[model samples]
Target: MNEYKDASKESFNDDFCSYLEHHLTRAFANAEDELVQKVWCDGVLMPFFENQTSKKSVNDTKRIVTKAWIGQDGQGEYELVIKFEKYSLRKYARGSSLQDCVPSERTLDWINIDLARRTIEIQLT
Candidate 1:
């Protein structure tokens, strides 16, 4: 049986969420913003696409914000859903990175990490 199907439904506390957010931030501290966004989405969504039941189309333009929080997965263990939002380039956008893009107000995607299995999953719309 798939481990995800047998996993328990539990919520991670605020401390754990904070730890995860910090961890991801540190891991990608030297990387470019676009690279960080790509890594998170690819890491989490690859498994979703490999499953026979999934048939969702992903928008690659979304960017990850390195912010994570506990989120329920219905049947499986609670996951850390990393925030991925839309970003658009503006000529006047100022930042340390030359390729900086302005982030949208709302999240456009999520990448869920299951700590027990060290796996990532997401529900695509």
Candidate 2:
């Protein structure tokens, strides 16, 4: 059983890596413009949503409220804060069939965009 669990976990990681590689490759295909890449990456808080929350339905109401910013020291580091209103699961279910609907908790995710090397790194805290 343990061996099977380990294998399953490894498979999930492998699949996730493959998915990320494919997605990022497609996203960066025409990413010649720095602002375009920044906008595309920063426009949606994918990292935060992917890492912080276990609920998949949160994406329905979540949106990026701000743009990415870098510190004054030019450290190749960038940060963006996203804000969304909180809702209750019961309230959401009132009009929809979704269960466990609730106001999303305010969350902030920081991302580092390296324009020189054309790489994006997410910091999980």
Candidate 3:
């Protein structure tokens, strides 16, 4: 297990999210040298439903990594777990129609990596 404190500087844009993804990908790549050249990875963010309106769904805005770890389960499957700090970037300026809202940091979100399956799964809010 590894902790990545301040993995990146806080930003109003999605740059922080991109940085987290890049670092996570690198960690995945470094897990196993034998599978490095042969592995292919992909991921999906399951749609999130709003609590107030079940018919409406929420989208992810920004993310930052706080911790990560690679381990083998009882089944001998390698798994990578990443804990990320989430944020909501105000798309519109306060009291304005323009998309210029400041970014606000939120709580943590989790991402699970299956090295053997070459897939990533998000346990997001």
Candidate 4:
């Protein structure tokens, strides 16, 4: 199965929400506006397309952020719902050099991402 196949409702609620909030914080890190703290990710309605590149056997995927809704709740918190085209792990090149398999050497050509979010979020204590 694909590595990202487990992006279920629970994952969206528990994982992706916080992940997006963190991403939002970083995206606005260099900005001078007050929008950063007011941002929050509430939910998602993701519908994935077939994994077109699965047959190719690479370990990265590409996604398109299709839509985003941002608004303030009646309460003090802000809410968000982001939509995106489903993504699957991208395929590796057939003629890649042996060293290319090293993660630091391998590049994900599918999506544009912030350098801070590029590092793994979970680490052993």
Task: List TM-scores for all candidates, in order.
Answer: 0.22, 0.28, 0.28, 0.30
Per-residue C-alpha lDDT of model 3 across residues 6-64, encoded as one tens digit per residue: 21222212443344444444444454444432332332211222231111112233332
Worst 10 residues of 2 by lDDT: 99-108
Q: lDDT tens digits, residues 1-125, model 1?
A: 66553110111123333444343434333334443333321121211222221111112322222223322322332332322223321111111121222122133233344445644432222
RMSD of each: 16.3, 12.4, 14.1, 11.9
lDDT values, one for every candidate: 0.28, 0.33, 0.31, 0.29
Score residue 88 of candidate 4 by CA lDDT: 17
User: By TM-score, how accurate is candidate 1?
Assistant: 0.22
**Model 1 stretches with alpha carbons more than 4 Å out:** 1-11, 30-34, 37-125
Model 2, range 1-125, lDDT digits (tens) per residue?
45433221231133433443334334443455455344332122234333322232434534222223222222333333322234432232233322222111121122334555544543221
The lDDT, on a scale of 0 to 1, for candidate 1 is 0.28
After TM-score superposition, what is the CA distance of residue 106 in candidate 1 from its true location, in Å?
Answer: 30
TM-score winner? 4
Better of 2 and 4 by lDDT: 2
Q: Could you say which candidate leads in lDDT?
A: 2
Instruction: Tell me which of candidates 1 and 2 scores higher on lDDT.
Output: 2
Q: Point out where model 2 deviates above 4 Å.
A: 1-12, 30-112, 117-119, 122-125
Question: What local lDDT score does residue 33 receive in model 3, on the 0 to 100 scale?
Answer: 46
Candidate order by TM-score, decreasing, is 4, 2, 3, 1
